[model samples]
Target: MEKIEKFEIYQRRFLGNKLKVMPLIEKIIESEIKNFNSFCDIFAGTGTVGWYFNKENLQIITNDLLYSNYIPLRAFLSDEEFDEKKIEELLKEFNSIKDCEDNYVSINFGNKYFCNNNARIIGEVRERIHKYFLNDIINPKEKAILLTSLLYAMDKIANTVGHYDAYRNIKDIPYKPLKFLMPDIDKRKNQNNLIFNMDANILIREIECDVLYIDPPYNSRQYSDTYHLPENIIRWEKPELHGKAMKFDRSTLKSKYSSKEAAKAFADLIENAKCKYILFSYNNMANKGHSRSNARISDEEIMEILSKKGRVKIYEKEHKEFTTGKSKRGDNKERIFFVKVKK
Candidate 1:
């Protein structure tokens, strides 16, 4: 059979929101789908893996700790109807709101981040989005689309640098937001599904499924930093910002998920998760701790723990893009490690 791409994740989110190589994952689970009627994704990031695997009429469980992450996933995967006309109407009302300044847009706390025009547009749209949620006129899919559209708009108009590091370079206005930024999304046929707002480690113990898919943060690149602005916009709550006009807590904080405890923590999560099979998606990087830090979990470290679980099967593929100039990209191999627990 030929390899086919299920979702266009990379094309849609190239500069930010990088994803792990997924074909190996598709192949690993291709044979096992029949045995399991329910699926659970602990780190359901953008729902790329869960949404793609949502064939066979099986229920999919998706989770993420951040409110921003949870909102988008919930919007995408939940059982909700999407009403286009109503959303359009809401947008009309939102864009009518007055700008605080000619170029000023209202962010959290009425503090301005972008140029007045960008902020004004974002502020107006955000107001209407909040109204939509309050009126409760539509379902979860609609909500997700609303959230997604806003994020996409934010990405284009945001003054910050790519990958959401800071706004130091974005010293001016941005391109205008198109009306159909989010368009419409197909509602996931999520039968018997679950969504969670907890840590990956904590949830592993309680959830049980035939297959568990783990694509954790490869290095210490905290996810919060990469997409922090969109998260803030969706949260619709102004947070204290440290520098470059982003949420202080998110930008300045450390994630236990940030390889601060990745090795022991992930091993524990995998060990305790009451699942028959486990597949981990990570690359073999010499620099593991973080961009400017040391290694926390090495290639040997992970293989050791997963080895104890079952007879491990490994497949590696090239990372299509990376900052490094290497042919294989950041790591020589984007490793897929599969372990099966006896039923």
Candidate 2:
């Protein structure tokens, strides 16, 4: 089989609002009367938007609660140049590891999310990557790149649609062999590039940038719950899981964005953001009759919070939401709030 050249193949598989609003964001950036040197993605899900800005010579700072997301951010946003030969050699070594029996993912998730064979392979590969890190064989950036490769590879062959909530009920699951690929490293280096794996609320207080882009969860769905399997693979701590979804204890990873406190959290973020301009991407999915109709904050609430901080302008574009179950497709619109902070 021929190799795919698309840089966003893995990112396209991510389960969230990403990449779709880039053109609109770019337009906003151009028109918003900005002179920005540093860009911050406070809720960098897959680092897609931040990476987009990084290419435009902005010093990028990306933060996410999920450990899985941090891996890719570290790999893509690093200032250091990576040798293609070294990356290829690392991939070769990772692929060469034989699938072992009863590894963490295999023992817990075998015959559940992935088939036993694939699960075993995931476990073995994870172990090898962990071992490489422990033995100091690979540097921190190299470890991130290799782990990100494995994460993307596993995502490709996952039996679910995009998330790890449930696996498809199939008698004979498709056995696609896992293959690691080199991530498209951003060579246009910015010395101040930073990545963080912390709660957005806490992180916002410490970082100050010229442009702050906020893309928090719109509904009551916690990302840690949705992407638990990937998080597990990233942390590699062999956590104690529970319930039908086989989720680990994510008590520490829960976001206020998914709770009744969401409005307050949004307000706090806006207050704490040290930026000239703030852009927020949110969807009008609250009134849409769906399982996730329980939106954390209303549009009016969001507008009210943001208005207190600055002069705000709203942009709207129709978007097709990817949903499952008995959710009917309807008119979906993504709203971007461009705010000029009050000096």
Candidate 3:
């Protein structure tokens, strides 16, 4: 078994991820926008777009509401110092642990989201990471890296399709032991990058960037509910969970963009945005899926809201859609609304 470099930050199978359309996005920005210094991914899901545009001369700002996402943002983009050898040693130690007592994950999420043995290991490793951080044995960046490694590893082995909304009915889930891998972080570029765990609408007014990239949830599916398992593991609050999905109280984490008030939220966000350019990523699933899975903001509403800002241009690319259930997303085409904000 050779040491493989397989842990890239973009490897996760995240729904509505911009991994495939990244090239189209970059092409539009490079061709149209010029003399830009900062790129802000206000609703960065996996932090893929921000990291893709991370250049030595450009500043990167990424924000997400979930701690699971924010930790990875800090781990990959922030210029915090971390010990490499210590991290490698800790991974080896965690992988070798055979005896782990019953903990939150094992007790609550075992056999549902993950297999029992892997769930126990997850609990044990998360506890150790928390203890190490509290005891000052590891720096914040190191802790983030470790937690991110655990998250990526768990995402690989989870019994869900692409998100934790529901799990498949596998009576005897295979014994795929959790293995940690070091994230491929670019250490030498854009040391001034900033990371935040704040609401995107509130954050829009506080920050200014040359290029503001917006990729909000397109449907009623809230990311917090979808990724609750990872959120619980990262926050480690061990709160009371309910429902068949084993979800904790996420009242505060729900985004209005995923609700009926999506058009209003988009309007407010655009009204306060202080940027030279706005790049909005949306899809043509307005009427494709079920009522809950349909696009919250219609194309007409999006056009009307953005037209008031400045000149708007639309870019379309045919891409495959990611769905959770029987909902059909036929003939999906990602649309990027490029707006040059009025000065």
Clashes per candidate (backbone, < 3 Å)? 7, 0, 0
Cα lDDT of model 1 by residue, 1-343, tens digit? 2221122222244331325556667777786444677777787776677777675468777787666667766656666656766666555544444554431135442223355555666766766567766887655566666676666555555554455665544434444543334343455465556777678888887788877887776666677776666766777676666665545577433456566687888778867988878877776665532353333577787889887787788877875434533233334566778888765
Q: How well does model 2 score by local distance difference test?
A: 0.82
TM-score to true structure, per model: 0.81, 0.94, 0.97
Pairs with backbone N, CA or C atoms under 3 Å apart (clashes), candidate 1? 75-144, 103-116, 103-117, 104-116, 105-119, 105-120, 108-238
* C-alpha lDDT score of every prediction, in listed order: 0.63, 0.82, 0.90
Off by over 4 Å in 1: 1-20, 31-35, 81-84, 91-114, 135-142, 168-171, 178-183, 251-254, 288-295, 324-331
Q: What digit string (tens of lDDT, one per residue) describes model 2 on residues 1-343?
A: 2342324423547766577878889889998855689999999988888888785467899989889888888988877555567667768766666657787888898887888888998888888778877997777888887888888888888888888877777777878777788788756664679889998989988999988999998888788888999999889999898987789999998899988899999999898888888899888888776646556789889889999879789998887776775677578888898898998
Write down the lDDT that model 1 would get. Answer: 0.63
Write candidate 3's Cα lDDT for 159-232 as tens digits: 88889988888898888877788888888875889999999999998999999999999999899999988998
Q: What is the lDDT of residue 42 in candidate 1?
A: 83
lDDT of 3: 0.90
RMSD of each: 5.6, 2.2, 1.5
Ranking by lDDT: 3, 2, 1
Q: Which candidate tops TM-score?
A: 3
Q: Model 2, stretches more than 4 Å misplaced?
A: 1-12, 80-83
